[model samples]
Target: MSELNVELSETERSFGLRQIPAGHARMLVIGRCLPQPIGEVWNALTDPARIGAYFAEPQGDFRRGGDYELPGFSRGTILRCDPPRLLTVSWMPAHGNGGELEIHLADENGATRVELLYASVRKRFAVMDPEVNEWAAGPGWEFFLDNLSAHLDGREVRPTDRDWQSMEGTDRELYEARNTEWVRVREEFEREHSPLPSPE
Candidate 1:
């Protein structure tokens, strides 16, 4: 058991973090507050044109059961689309691995809260080194969410030069150790930012 951590931006109303369950699995959620109305944020996430401006080479269709391919990112079928509220999809990665991403939006105070839940990531590499596997998901989600937040707020979020630059040279044994540490802190962060009370 580890204490989840929170990393808040003093300069912006955005934050990101990770959560892991020992040797079982990991879940990552990253998002930000949009100064614009909920409808605008909804469009930015659901609109093909708006999504292309932030992530992927070009935006694909947004209808449920339709193809949602973004050049480099995994291509998959849209599982659900409840317009302005829920957008769920299954993403297929290059290695034949895939996962589901659920985007939820709600009106909070005056700003729209966008929550992205990237779950059930393939545990394909977890056996190799659960730690290293844990390493990839969080940062990857962070990168994507940061871009989404920036785009929604009319800011540009540049991709990092190297993805794993932060985890370069740590010993093999400590990889998972540090991963758990990050997971603990990240979970804490989510609890704090949660718009509603967490379900029991």
Candidate 2:
């Protein structure tokens, strides 16, 4: 129960539509700087043991073109792996639609700035609201990064579900505030960009 304080301002979020092989995909970009060296942050992200400690229990081959699964979460193939820098994968979640996930890491003044890009295609016949989608996905990534930050700071990390349930007091209040912030950001993004054309 390390203090669950997440600064929404620390994260840069954007929403747009991109063309993929399947069709038009809604792209969500979230970037935040972690106060740790680049190499240390990279290892925490790629190493199975380190990832399991902070994120989820990872299982499967972890090389380029290899398949991997984060039990009860998402499973997909490792599309590209460039150590200490970039890692791209085809992300197929246990629920909802699948997408492409890319992690970009860079050295920013001796600290690591990690950017996560997730793009999921709009279902052909299913109607979806881009604003709803952005807000829903944004907070989840923020939560994961919060855990990563705690882990980097040498704080105890807990399973996502249990950790979420255990949130109380200030932590719970901050979590709720984060969600509200996401809604505000999404609303602003929607006003700036026209909604995607309805699926045929």
Candidate 3:
């Protein structure tokens, strides 16, 4: 199978997406900016301690061909890892049933531009859809980035461990609705701010 490729430029001030052919379909390319240097941002992403501080359990060697294991979200081998620049990993669950996540970093005026290239997502993993990941990568990562910046600036950002394994009918419905709205808003946002250029 030919690997998918997503190229994103002008990311510090905008976001971009590209659909590439691989096996059966196209994968989404999501990205954003960070308010810290490349090394700081890279460490925040690759360092298990720092990642756990913001999100859930994070364990990975963060190198080419090394596997990263998180309890639920994803678990797979790293395909590429360039310190303070790029980290591409294959995300799988149940041993071997998933695809890849490619993260790119660029330096812009002392801050780091972080771009997430989520590729080769399988159809079976469609239930926990892109909307859910948006909740995590979009708003969730924004939340984490804010905390990371604060911590880097010598401020305090307390970590939390809250489990909500159970929710009533209305609660679950509301959660799903909100996440749907998030996806919509994110699409609108990208269109407005970084409208895809017309093909020549």
Provide the TM-score for each candidate, comma-separated: 0.63, 0.81, 0.57
Q: Which residue pairs in candidate 3 collide?
A: none
Model 2, span 17-132: residue lDDT tens: 66654467777788999999999988888889888888787899878889999876688899988989999888777555667878899999999999988777744312123343
Clashes of each: 6, 0, 0
- Which scores better on lDDT, 2 or 3? 2
**C-alpha local distance difference test of each model:** 0.57, 0.73, 0.53
The TM-score of predicted model 2 comes to 0.81
RMSD of each: 9.0, 4.7, 10.1
Best candidate (score: TM-score) = 2
lDDT of 1 by residue, 81-112 (tens): 88788988876666655566778888887678
Write one digit per residue (lDDT tens) for candidate 3, span 1-200: 21111111222222234342233322344456667788888887788876676665667766677777876556878787888798877766443435566778899999877776554434322122543332333333333445666566667763433212233464344434433444665566456756433222
lDDT of 2: 0.73
- Over 4 Å off in model 2, which ranges? 1-6, 122-135, 162-167, 197-200
Model 1, poorest ten-residue lDDT window?
4-13
